[model samples]
Every structure is written in C-alpha cells, then in structure tokens.
Target: VAGQFGKSAVAAAPTLLTKELTFNFQQKRSIQLAMVELEDMPVRSEAEELVFSLLIAILPERLPEQTQLLSNYPNPFNPETWIPFELSQDSKVSVTIYNVAGTPVRNISVGYLQAGSYVSQLKSVYWDGKSDTGERVSSGTYFYQIRAGDYTETRKMVILK
Candidate 1:
C-alpha cells in the first residue's frame, strides 16, 4: 500500500526517498548477478597481474635515445649551400628555409627517411637572390630548420648577390 502511494507520487516528486531506494535496490541486484558468475573466470585478473609484473621487471633495462643535426655548410653562400643531419630512428623528415622575417621560402625535404646521417644540397634554392616562385630575393639573412621525428633544429645563413 505505501509502495503504491510512493510510486504514484514519484510522477510529481521524482526524487522522493522511495525512488532513491529503488535505484539502489536495482544496482545491488545487478551486482549480485555479476558475482554469481565470477567463479568461472578468475584467470583474467591473474593474467593482468602477470603482464604488469613482467612489464615492471623489463622496462628499466632500456635507454633513451637522441637525434641531432650538424650545422650546415657554406654559412654565407652566394648560389649554393649544404645542410646535414642525423636521425636516431626512422622518421618523417622536413627541412624548410625561411627568410629573416620567418616566412617559409623553400621546402628542401618533405619525405620519410631511415635512421642515419644525410646531406642535402641547396643549389637551385640558394640566393642568386631569388624566391621560390623565382622572384629576385633581397640580400639578407635567412634561416633553415630541420625536423626529424620529435627533434627540431634551426640555423642561419647569409645571401649575397
């Protein structure tokens, strides 16, 4: 009788004590059903524990690695230069040239490479002083950056016409 009156009043007082009791009762019923089936699958927890133990035992034996790029050549070049770098891991690499004002002028590399040292020639790219679209670039300082994996490095060069 009381449960029926409480259920009818729930349409108006949605958060009455009876509604709270009903929600908790359903949750307890579901938990009881789940526990009734747990005895057949105890190995899941054991396997998870074993994997975690192995990872803890082996992870400390590894070392951190680093990647680097040696400074470029012909630092103050007229029409040509060279940029070199080394990668510690196989990575997607990009080398970009930018003017003193930080605008990208040329893309020297936009490709993937294996781990090793490499050199790139900047022949058609050097300042006869010209831009990528072949407009005459002014004599000024320019910068280039090499990006390999998670590493990045920048260096400056000069253009003299």
Candidate 2:
C-alpha cells in the first residue's frame, strides 16, 4: 500500500494479503484493518505496507455498526425490568442505575460483551428493583446508564410499585 501518512509518502514492495471477513449488518459501522504478513507468516513493518478490507462490510445482515442503549422493556414495572442495548465492538460493559435525585441506586457489572445486537430479553440486563446492597428500591422515576467502550447513553424508566 502506498499513501501519505501525514506529510511523508510511504511505499513498499508489492505483496499480497489474503483476508477473509464478512459483516452483514445494520447501518452504521466502522472497519479498518492494518497489518503486515508474508507468505502466511509475519512480516516486519519496515518490510511492507498493507491495508486489509473485508467483503461483508459492503453487504447487510449479521452485525451491528454502532454502540447503543435501547429502551428497556416494561418501563413501568412492579419489581423488575430488562435493559436492552447493542455494541459496535467488543467492550467491557457497565450498567448503573440512578434515582431521580441523581444518586446511584444500583450498579450492574456486565463485564465483557461481543459486538452485536443485544436487543432480546435474554441478552439484556435484569434489575430486580434492588440496589447494589440487595435491597428493594422505592421507585417512581429512575435513570439507567450504560457504558460500552467509548459509548454511553442514559434512559428513563418507572417502577409502579
């Protein structure tokens, strides 16, 4: 690959790169690949310049293109609710619920989730109207925020009990 990095023009010996990737997904995706390989083996950066591109990125079906926090199900609930969201890339997900007064009422540790749509009930986070200390919460209006990679969003929900 030959292109200007910034102000310097860099070129290298012509080498072939075989990359197999398919991403049939919803709108909104970012994909970039850069590496150096020679004859199915690794090559020093000083030896070559190449950019890898996938084929499925041009299609549309299997992956998510951006991170997002969708609305929760049964927003006005009795004692529990499910939070559904999606990620554009692999990330350590963290969910925190805050009361109307802007104080955290519950913190959900979601650990790691792969890049995809987690819109289904089974894939979403479940909060049993309880705080981190495992006590029931008196709810009217509450805020739920999710942190996935560099993306964050907060939505409102109600507990009718």
Candidate 3:
C-alpha cells in the first residue's frame, strides 16, 4: 500500500491516523500494519525527508498557555473603563456587567477572537457604565464577568457618579 501511494500521501497517512483514530485494538493493529508496510519499503533519503517535512507541517499549532482576565483600569471609574483579557486561542467571548444587587446591567458580546492579548482600548471592548438600554448606572459597586471558552471570571468595580 505504501508503495502504491505517492510520497506525500504516504507521509500524511500517519498524521491522519494519530488525529482521527482511537487507541482501540483495531486502530492499534492498523497502525502496526502501516508501520510494517512503511519499513518494508526500500531506503530512499528523499522520500524520508519528504515524510519528515510533511509530519512537521501536519502537526497542530501551539495553543495559549492560559486564559487570563486582567484588572480593569480606573477601577473606580466615572462613566467608562477599559476591560482587558488575554486568550491563548480562538474563543467566543462575552462580558456582562451586573449591579451590586446582581442584576445584569450591560451585556457585551465580543464574538470570536484569535489567540492574543486584547484590551478594551485596542479592541473597543470597554463598558460605558451604562445599562443595555443606554441608561447610566448609579454610583456603587458592580461585578463584571468574563466568559471565554471554558474559562469564566468575575471581578468587582466601582462607579463614582
């Protein structure tokens, strides 16, 4: 089978196996058979090199080490403040601001973002200290929650009207 396929196809087959195959007995047998067939082929340095390159290209890219929610600047803000966060990979992000009584005042949906650091300034993700209906909130403590993929975090802020 290895001899019948081109070098690129043969090289990519192993990568596909690891990604799509379960580690069950049948899968194991298939892997072993593939390895045996690969070994039986005549030694060709160029083919080996192509396989090596293909394997490297087929590997998945590295994800972020961790997701983080940084403290918002100007904690005791007047009408607005910047909320910052970092993501290791693409994710759907939602930010919600709740009053001290736990009532949701503002909900900001950031949609999908790629892996990187994002600030309210650069990304325009800031909350204008207003309710969803565009009314300014009263002065007091409030909670801001950030939900990104599997990560969830809540932080406190104050509004000094």
Candidate 4:
C-alpha cells in the first residue's frame, strides 16, 4: 500500500492541503491549535484508505505597507491600554500622548524599529494613563501621535477613571 503512494506522496500530501488553508489567531501572545476542514477527497485506491492528520503552526499575518499608527485598545480604560503600530521599514519612531487641551502628557521614544508589524503585547509598549511626571491624568478623550520618519499619524483614545 505504501509503495503505491510512494514516500514522497504521503509526506507531501499535507503541504498541498495547506496551500488552500488560511490560519487566523484571535489572541495575542498565545498559542492555539485549530482544526481546519479540507475539501472532500475521493478514495482512488486501497492505499488511500490510510488516514493522516496534519498539524500546521500558525503565525500572525504581516502587513507590508507604509508606516501606520494604529489605535490604542481597551479604550475608555481605567489605568492602562495597549498601543500597536506597524513599520514598513526601519525608522525612528516616537509616540506621544496628549490631553484634550493639546498638552503633551507622555512621550515614548521607540528609537529605531525594523520593517514589520508590531503589537503591544509583543512589543510591551503601553500607556498607563499617567503623565510624564508619574501622575495619573484625568479621564477623558486623549490623542496619541506617532512620528516615524516622514510618516506621521494621530489617533484618539478615551480614558475612563
């Protein structure tokens, strides 16, 4: 039976299935196993009666585009929230938090980053709803701006005390 399929045929069968399969991970900083269903296959020979299970390690997808300043998560947060961003290439990055009155509260300098996508959980860059002086800021709407090379963007976030 194995001779009919050949060793390479059995070994490479899983690779062919993955070509039509897409993986999606819902959580950050976590590993999960998900079963995917493939299209129905027709049994051609007795050798094909052998069943095989394939396991593929999935990773987060990447967005290879221009620099982007993504929004902070858990908005209307009490103390802290995550900030995520993406860099298409290596560049100096800076993130600043400002109050509604247009005053800079905290400045986070990322310095230099390579070209890739970055998430707060992976990068550990978060805002603790505090000013640079280590004092907690009032609850309200705030803005965060990212300056990376010549690519700049501003986004709004909410803090709920």
Error in Å for residue 86 of model 1: 0.7
How does each model score on TM-score?
0.51, 0.63, 0.59, 0.62
- Name the lDDT value of residue 6 in candidate 2: 36
Which candidate has the top score in lDDT? 3
Q: Against the correct fold, how does model 3 do in TM-score?
A: 0.59
lDDT of 3: 0.75
Instruction: Report the Cα lDDT for candidate 4.
Output: 0.70
Candidate 1: tens digits of C-alpha lDDT, residues 34-106: 4333433556575454443333232212211356766667767776667776665677888788988899888
lDDT values for all models: 0.59, 0.71, 0.75, 0.70
lDDT for predicted candidate 1 compared with the true structure: 0.59
Best first by lDDT, ranked: 3, 2, 4, 1
Off by over 4 Å in 1: 1-65, 120-130
Residues 18-115, candidate 4: write the lDDT tens digits.
67766443341122212212113443334333332333223224434577877688877889988888887678988899988999999999888766
Question: What local lDDT does model 4 show for residue 118?
Answer: 76
Rank order (by TM-score, best first) = 2, 4, 3, 1
Over the stretch 14-120, how does candidate 3's per-residue lDDT look in tens digits? Answer: 67775764455344444444444544577747765564455444433323357888888888999899999888667899999998889999999999887656865
